[model samples]
Target chain A: MILVNENTRVVVQGITGREGGFHAERCMAYGTQIVAGVTPGRGGTLWQDKVPVFDTMEQAVRETGANCSLIFVPAPFATDAILEAVDAGIGVIACITEGIPVQESVKVYSYLKDKRVHLIGPNCPGLISPGARCKVGIMPGDIHRPGTIGVVSRSGTLTYEAVAQLTEAGLGQSTCVGIGGDPVTGTDFVDILKLFNKDPDTEGVVLIGEIGGAKEQEAARYIKRSFKKPVVALVVGATAPPGKRMGHAGAIITGVSGRAEEKIRALREAGATIVPSPGEIGVTMKRALRR
Target chain B: MKIHEHQAKAIFARYGIPVPEGGVASTPQEAREIAQRLGGRVVVKAQVHAGGRGRAGGIKVVDSPEAAQQAAVALLGKHLVTHQTGPEGVPVSKVLVEQVVPVERELYLAIVVDGSGKAPVIIGSEAGGMDIEEVAAIHPEKILQVRVDPIIGFQPYMGRDLAYAMHLPSAVVRNAATIIGNLHRVFIDEDATLAEINPLVLTPDGKLLALDGKLNLDDDAFFRHPTHQQLQDPEQEDPLEVEAGKYDISYVKLDGDVGCMVNGAGLAMATLDVINAAHAQPANFLDIGGGGDEAKVAQAFRLVVADPKVKRVFINVFGGILRCDVAARGIVQAYGELKTPMPIVVRMRGTNAEEGRQILNDSGIPVRLVADLKEAIAQLQQVGRR
Candidate 1:
């Protein structure tokens, strides 16, 4: 399991809110170890009549021995929630909350540099390990099946599209991670690719990227150097105009490096089979693995 | 969330950064009054969000107040087309009139978020007063960058290093460093993604003045800076896009015939790409977000069909937090409300997808449901052919 497994004790931040409660129930139904819930001033309460609720992360950690944090806090307080989780010694954090300011995200990124923690996203769908039955995000659990293909993407529904296609192609995913669509995210493609490369269960990897930033190029370089697995890549936003942010904050073509063609060329040169469109993600990955 | 040049200059001046004396004018009379007060050679610049105003005849320099009025009259309420703005261009409602400083040299300075680094980087160059992208492409080595750690923040020594790297004169190195520090402070304090001073000029008196200023605030950080949010001009944006924002939907208008409404940003862009691949242009990019209820989805649908160029609508939703049933109901409701004969195609999956498809199938609406992306593209192509 790259980020989560059956033994991972999860704490639900902002569990009392509507979105948090709803997703927590879904994750629990998927057989995840949702050990505790945290909402300020909601201590000693029972969430869904089973999970324990605490006012702070520290108390939740002390009582439940939670190792992972799934945050659904609002944008304004989401940064503080991540820091709280970090301080409480949570090993892994997946923030589902979107629209966190870049300044706050950068500060969190700086603070987490020395800490022994894995932060997934401030604006992402989160990650899931189908084989381990460990779902840690807002992704629909039923669509994922247990297998060896590892998928990492900078999108939410687009990751779902790829995962569903993979499952349909008889290539069940070991884990699917959405690093997020924000300009500054906690974890990136390279970090997740490294985990996927080392995991024994993950046979191959599929990287989904969009416009904006040189992150795909960085991942392409890493794949060429050390990754010893079949890789298939798909970069969207080929038709997107420059400078106009297409829904995602990070999906804008600012300069020459942020264009989709540049990223596609870099990935193609690095020996990864490039899928021409979103429709081809599954068959392309299967083909790359066979070769 | 880009602020006008005058607004950026105001913010810069508040931080004790030196900028040429300027005033914003919306009318020719106001321009004349401001120019008379400056009492010297002044430049009238269109206060649009785009760059390249100087090359597009949006900027005019005059020695007299009458000439300033004439320049304002020529620019005000007229569309100023530049390379940044498309053929239609943006209307110049206001102009900034400033006293022109005698320049000894021009330098570039800006603080922007380095996306990959996840930190703010201070970019400086000796070559300025032109497009920075051009300079970066032609002379890549001329661009100097210093990444500022958000934890320790921008240090004075880093500013000193940047000043020395720019090869500034000894007399103004300390002053340049101070301005850089102040600019960094402004970037952090204002929650700005970009705080730039292109053409930081050196006057004959050895004083550094920000000749042109541009500041882009982080839209996500607007909750903290409510005052900054008030600076947004709705007139400058597409009316439909502004309407979509009111319903918490992200919408960008495009010159395409097929309208796309998807749940996520990446999926929406991919939808556009696929539509284009099918030889059908997407009229707009619209995302109703993760948890779109019936009402929000209806609003999003209305926003998409509101575009006259949109002949058909395509809804591709891989529902997670947003249930397929809810989206289907919303689309059906919107179709009924609009009472238009526009064709609609949907590819719904994930949570409650079967129920959602059933709802759409029985809605008495003539909607085509496709099983996969390829099928959906084929349907879109057929619709375009009609």
Candidate 2:
């Protein structure tokens, strides 16, 4: 059911900008069928890799027939790029920009739900379906191999750390999605978990979560009811006592249900393997897979 | 970051907060000249960025200008240890020779961004010149907090209410109002993380003054106020951590085994906890935040590998915005350059991870990637474990 194929044409917003150009070049290097770039007032300009450029996403989609969009726009312009990509009917959009204000992320989140679109990270590293030969966002591509475990995280580096652990144990991944650290993300942990559960390539999954958000608990509940595949969960911010400790945007600790202990309890009750340390994530995933 | 006492007092003066008249001096001669001009018994205080200096011999009451000069000669360029600044002594860069005021009473007042409810709170107390933690533990009721409306900030009347609760006299209460107003102004204008006036003294003349001060500015907002940044004393900060910040990586030095490199602040903190639970202390918290370029990762790797305490390097990256392979290449490149014998425990997830692993494997580096969080942590716990 992974409908997107390797040849899915892609366009990058803010493509001439530093992050855009960097990732655009990386994606191009990985042979991700990149088609066009959209940067206002810089239309018809071309980056060195020679992807056709446009002033607007609509034009980029119209001219280049790009179905998927990689957005490397700055935080101040993230909402606009996401909205524009959605409006342009670019079926898939990945916003890799960090520090997008929470309010902007909320607005963009609301905008994405009404449309038939799959949006990844306003503060994420983007998504990669391995062995399919596609790269989007800032994630380093070379470490990945096609295998059973699929990763979905609210954190970029934590996800990378988790995936790296998996790969070290000779456990390859089917897909890994950093859902972004913002409170309001395009895809939630449960949503990505659902995707991984259905994907045949992903036999097991790892979810690296932080404090502050209730997404981890929600994901645990969803796994209890829906997921047939084994899941390994590691919740960060454990020793951080409640005096002034708060976690990520979606990290839901403090108001009773959001505590690390509570989340770990829920995950334990939900039949998912829980790893206390970040380093144990890989072994935990392999053990979960064996079970 | 924290600002020195003299700098804090200067900022207080700008906002109309009453601080003891003082001049900063880099040398004993300058201290003597300033004390002579003040023409009275003065307090020679080491201008380090720590509290509890009085207990650490960093503060001296000099009866004459000659005494002030002698005190400055002993303190300047020397390290002063305080209970608050940890065991490492704070380097005294400047001496603050201020006109001494007879204190009838001492009170505490501070405005800090309360991480709870995402609101700012004013913490004030009748008893001052003591650790706020000790105050909270013992006479918690004497403390007053008035949460401000984020839109309007602290109103003047609320400041008066807090002062009243602290049981100030009529004359001191009015001074408290102006001080609170000044504090609010400083908080809003400078985007301060914490601003405190400990021992806001009531003089023999029944006048109120901010006797001692501390201000912590938000680093993220530092770009807006370049001038206030001159107040930073790099001597108080860890050199490696400062170096890490240049690369945009958040590296906090801790005593532990594995050198952790993760993106995202929230995740990095959690990574430390896990290493601790595994009975291994994380040597450093290196958030090779977001960009994850070869240069940054290389710098981070060199730093961790250079540390003799770091028996293992646990790299747990979930490639969301960062690619595992790019990180792998960075590791490969950095390892080749550093040529370190330290064992590296590699665990990567999220987008293009295999290519990253391939790069690490191909580099002839014996980096091992783990498939689970607990196992990798366990591996990292035993640096030489196969």
Winner by DockQ:
1
Q: What is the lDDT of candidate 2?
A: 0.76
List, for all models, the DockQ compared with the true complex.
0.86, 0.21
Residue B281 deviation, candidate 2, in Å?
2.4
Off by over 4 Å in 2: A1-16, A20-154, A159-275, A279-291, B337-340, B366-369, B384-386
C-alpha lDDT score of every prediction, in listed order:
0.92, 0.76
DockQ of 1: 0.86
If scored against the real structure, what TM-score would every candidate get?
0.98, 0.70
Segments in model 1 whose C-alpha atoms lie over 4 Å from true places: none
Question: Which CAPRI tier for candidate 1?
Answer: high
**Model 1 lDDT per residue over A154-229, tens place:** 9999999999999999999998999999999899899999998899999999999999999999999999999999
